[model samples]
Target: MRIRFKLDGQDVEVDVKHTDTLLKVLKDRIGVGSVHFGCGEGSCGACMVLINGRLRYSCLTLAGYVDGKEVTTVAALARDGELTEIQRAFLENDAAQCGYCTPGMILTAKVLLEKNPSPSDEELFDALAGNLCRCTGYIPIINAIKSVSRR
Candidate 1:
């Protein structure tokens, strides 16, 4: 089946199988390597992406389900070789260790900040609850979100 969607900031069309997950289509066919496949189940949140401005686990989302939607990955957060504020905060706070979960974390935080602008600590925790980072111990990650939210 042929699927069409807005990826990053460009309109993209590709042929995909019905069973193909968004993570596979993004990485394999579209050459988007940032969306990693950690657990293949939705539990890890490593494959998170924004579809029509909502966060969704790409590992469990079928390619066909996203047809005609807008898909944004971590790659979209950086523009003109400059990182977004959340990315900068993550770096300043040292939120990443292994770096496998940074993309999903940043994207999830992006959605949160966009909606709330100034979220409380609990709201930040709730926003990032779905994402898991085996490294960094989560304090720095929470601090990073707080830093960005305070700005």
Candidate 2:
């Protein structure tokens, strides 16, 4: 089926199979590098994307499910060679290691901050519970998210 959605602020149309996961479509067909393929079972947040402003696991979301929705990735958070505030905070705090989970973590953090600019540490932990970062632990990531809200 042919699906149409706004990807990273641009309109996109693609043909996908019923079994095609959103992760495959974004990485393979659309060539979106930020959405990583992790567990492929939605257990890991590596494939998280914002569909109509809500976080969803791209690995579990069928391509056709977002036929007319808005999909936002980390690539959209930056503009004209400048990083978004959250991105800058991540960089300042060294929130990434191995970089496998950075995109999802950043996206999740963005949503968390958006919904509650002053999330408690426990809330921050809960927001990032789905994302697993074997390296760098999560201190830097937590600091990055907290920094954004502080400013």
lDDT of 2 by residue, 1-151 (tens): 9999999999999999999999999999999998999999989899999999999999999999999999999889998999989999999998888999999999998899889999988888999999999895699999889988954
Using all chains and alpha carbons, the TM-scores for the candidates as numbered come to: 0.93, 0.95
Q: In model 2, which regions exceed 4 Å deviation?
A: none
Could you tell me the TM-score of candidate 2? 0.95
Candidate 1 lDDT: 0.90
The best candidate by TM-score is 2
Best by lDDT: 2
Q: The CA-based lDDT of model 2 is what?
A: 0.93
73-119, model 1: which lDDT tens digit per residue?
99888889999899999999999999999999999988898899999
- Scored by CA lDDT, what does every candidate get? 0.90, 0.93
Regions of candidate 1 where Cα sits further than 4 Å from its true position: none
Error of 1 at 139 (Å): 0.6
Clashes of each: 0, 0
